[model samples]
Target: MGMNAASVLNHIINGEPTTPCSSKGATSSQAKALTTTIINHLRLGRLGKAVSVLFSAPVPFPFALYVHLFRICASKKAIVEVRKVESHLVSFAPTPPVFLLNRAIEAYGKCGCLVDARELFDEMPQRDGGSWNAMVTAYSQNGYAGKALGVFSDMHKSGIFAAEVTFASVLASCASILALWLSRQVHALVFKYGFGGNVILGSSLVDVYGKCRRMGDARRMFDEIERPNAVTWNVIIRRYLEMGNGKESVFLFFKMISLNVRPLTFTVSNALVACSSFRGFREVIQIHGLIIKISYEEDEVVSCSLIDVYAKCGDLVCARTIFDLLSPKNLIHWTSMVSGYTLSGKTRLARELFDRMPERSIVSWNAMLAGYAHSSQWDEAMELIILICNDMRNTDRVTVSLILNVSAGLSDLELGKQVHGYMYRHGFYSDLSVANALLDMYGKCGNLRKARAWFYEMRHFRDMVSWNALLSSYARHRMSEEALVIFWEMQQEATPSKFTFATLLAVCANIFAREQGKQIHGFLIRNGYDLDIVIRGALVDMYSKCRCLDYALNVFIGTSVKDVVLWNSLMLGCYYNKQSEAILKLFELMKEDGVKPDSTTFQAVLLACISQGCVKLGGQYFNSLSQDYFIIPQVEHYESMIKLYGLHGFFDELEDFVEKMPFQPTAPMLARVFDSSKEYNNTRLGKWAVRHLSFLKD
Candidate 1:
């Protein structure tokens, strides 16, 4: 095909003027053929020959010649050849026109050769905002936010009136930089320039606020707009999901749908995330159905999001089904499914799928490690950490955090120390997240001394997790005073979270610190954190343990909502106060309210029975434990049984049961029953107690 076309071109070029027999018509035909050949060469990117043919041929070249060459250089990012074509244009019989300069600017911009593009824009004696917009766009595309802003400023200073494209480019810069203040300034300029209502500008404003974590502002802008495009809806909805307002995000989706705004692939993906965050299977299915209805169900982004949504919401089977159907699975799709299994505590299945993956990313490894850590499978988590440590490609702060978390659950002080050494050797000890995890691990593993050392060593700026870890450590070690001190420090320096109040409440419960507990309660109510269940439960348990039963009761009754654990706290408080009637009433109330009693409830009830010598009720409840509640009697139940039996003069039965029991009685149980023989004999209860105590003591 090439040879035929080239021969036709040669014949036309050589025969054009020599024949002279009405050769004007022949020459026209030859010129047309030569131009066709040159176009084909340029299209094929045979640049040398195309340039030669253009320069050597008698046929005149069109503007298409330079434009084609510019495209090839831009696509290949061949800056040298692009400049060559420009220089050749200058030597042309007439200089290339303004239209040609624009093509060159676009090419340079696309190729990230902004310096050259800027030079060209400056060299132009006559300029327009379009030319300046091109330069600003080049800077924005290349991640040069500062340069983009500077160019935008110059464009304004030169009195080049801003156009929609100009504002759009500047907004891109602000969004990249997360410069909300600058973005607002740009919005004002857009309004000043009569481009405020532009769909493109409105979308950029929504995006800017979302990036700045100002979702409310973004929503306000979205609502203020009379009409919003799909991009506007997508940006706001995505922000809602990121902010953990999944319900609001879904509401926005419904609103968008009501307006008949069609969703794109991005919209479907975001809606799927909202579904996952809410963990509403029905809503997820609804979104999935909508995706299918919109014909984006099979799209790569949408399908990946579907797998993620289902996996996050614990629909692993559906996630796996979707994974099997995707023809070409990427890393993200595989990672999502693996993360789902890991998070759901199905580590074995997650590991199986992880190994089956054709390839893995660092995120996949992190997911597997985190799964093991979360499920308390410490050995496996540590093994993966060792593997990651040995492998040069996989080591990172996230991996270290996973391993540290596992160590925290195991409370293996020795292994935690080893991880600290490894972190130091790798120069990762200074990484705040890694350091925080290490501090948390040491705290959880009961090495509060070492945890405190690491805490003080951390850079002065502390995050919530840092403070929470330290406070939790002190609480676990019964150092309530120190924990309270740190908590107040946290409140003074930073905003306290539910974890902060919860940890402090735990300390108060441990030491029965009533004054401190009330202070935290006041803080909770003042901060509007009283309704947070974790914090509320902590306060209830603290007040109960501190012997402030009246206050505890008020808080407990005031809250209309209560879970099983909350009821358990109240019942335990009654047991501690020796208020047997209150314990029974609370248990009946719990049952009436449909809150199932747990092991703690059984413990509290048994203690109440032992306190009052309610043998008939104790035996009945003990039998109910095994038959109705399916609770195999633990050591505490046996201790309570022995006490009840000893109190009721069932000496032989207690003695025989103690002899055949699976474990030894605790020190307190022995002291309470056997060491009281003097008082027992004085009270005429000697014979019964001696019979049970003789065999166990011997």
Candidate 2:
């Protein structure tokens, strides 16, 4: 007979497994061959063919089959195929190996199937620290901080030693949750495992403690480690800044330099943030020097911070200089420069820079809008709002808030109405910030009723800033009763901020309502809030307005950290209360203590003299203002002098003074001279005023 197909295959299968002729059973060798074939097909990227071949085989290579399916499903993002392998595990009577279980968990985690990952973790017959760490890391990476910590706790109970990666992930988890207590426990465990000194682990711990606002603990851990790397020093510095200890942050930064530790780019960037946070230009310049030494001063992040510092410090020249020197100006750098110009009230310069940016983000648009708002260039601000609306990228919350502020500054009811329409159309009217902005705009635009409606609508979703903004709007519009009502309402849910009280106190001064003022004062004192300069200033102004000089004095005296502006406010308070003698006394006290009074102080003193009918004293103070303070008095000063002269019947002296003045008189000046001549009935002064007024009009 001819060689049959089976007979021929058997003759060739000399070293291979013999066929099951008598029994319908496959040998282990045949199974091995089948598994090898399926795994090879999977490795070749032919997953469909591998599945088909394995399923068609009389015997199954369960391990290889599961591995093949897992790889394909994980790679293809195919959830169904991945679940098939998981379901296959449930049907198997024999337990899968530990490596196989870990593989399944890893595949699930990498695929972002956290639920399956957790289920697999819990179902593990026996788990090592590696298994626990994997689950914890997955949970942490997926933003599940609580579960990550729970897994870590389980790892501890199981006595599975945490490796370096485990500590890193868990420490990061603690930082994310801001769980200081759990983080401390983890830190103790890290030290116990002798991984405390690891550079990466130590750095992570520093970050964790710093994020938890435990700057001292972060510093301690940093100091305990011998020869910390750049990352370690950076973490400690970042922590100091985050904790509002900019002064200490600068100290530690210098310490790092003394220790010959070179800071990374992030270090310089964070140091710049520290400067911005503290409003410390001195420290910013120091950071600049360090950055330049390290050849990172010109980096976009560093330059952006420098620009922000100079701008916020009202040093527009320096801000512009830094901005100009940047090699490739990015959106952040442009935003900082433009924002600086805006805050400093340099609208033209800000607009020029805004127009010059190569690309503008929503931040850049907001900066431009803010610049216009701050400079009181309302028309331009409104125009830009329209332009921002036309641009798709400018539809963000920041842009909306900025436009609202612009409308508020302009007090343009028409423009504000347009913005409100835009806000409603964009579905941003429901956002509390947008709503607050609208309320503030309406209040500023003399639409207090509209502002009230918006405020009432926002009651269901109350945030501190929104409430404060509404109160401030009421204060600004002299709606004292409404402002007080909002203040009382805010107290029911949110804690009243310094700003809320400050606005309420401002309302008190506007209406000169002593009863309301005292109520706020009592609340401030009871809450230990009287020591705040802002609150004290408002209180002083309020009491002074109500003619309660003793109360104003007490508030001023109670302030421990009085800013120069606060002291000036107190002096003005005295003047407002008709206590000219007290004003002079305060002025002398301010100068004697080396407070270095500015031009405003001199002007206030002159006004006090005029109010007291001390003409000669006013003249002496005015002359001193020009000579000593170098304050070239404007028309307002000259008008005050004319009023002083008319009151004392010193027309001859006024005429002589007017003749000696260098500047051509403004219309207001001529009007003042004309009015004074009418009172004194001086023909010569009257003729001079007519000529000057005609010239001014011409």
How many residue pairs clash in each candidate at the backbone level?
A: 0, 0
State the C-alpha lDDT per candidate.
Answer: 0.78, 0.77
Q: Tens digit of lDDT per residue, candidate 2, span 1-698?
A: 23553343233233233322223345555755766676566557676666566455554344534654676677776665566566655444256667667767767876888999988888878887778878988888878899889988988887788899999999999999899998888888888888867888888888998898877788788877888999888889888887787777777877888898888787777777766766778877777777787888677777777787777776788888877787777788878888888888888888887888888888788878877877778799878877886875547877777777886777668877987898888888888778777877887788878877877878788589878877887777677887888788888889987888788777888888899889877887798864577778888888888889898888788777677677788888878877777778888888777777776777678777777778888888889876887777766677777777766778887777777777766687777778878777877888889987887777
Cα lDDT of model 1 by residue, 504-537, tens digit: 8888888888998898788778878656666667
User: Which ten contiguous residues of candidate 2 have the minimum total lDDT?
Assistant: 15-24
Best-fitting candidate, scored by TM-score: 1
TM-score of each: 0.81, 0.78
> Candidate 1: where is the Cα deviation over 4 Å?
1-63, 76-105, 113-126, 213-217, 223-227, 258-261, 324-331, 387-392, 421-427, 446-450, 526-531, 619-698
- 10 residues in a row with least lDDT, candidate 1: 14-23
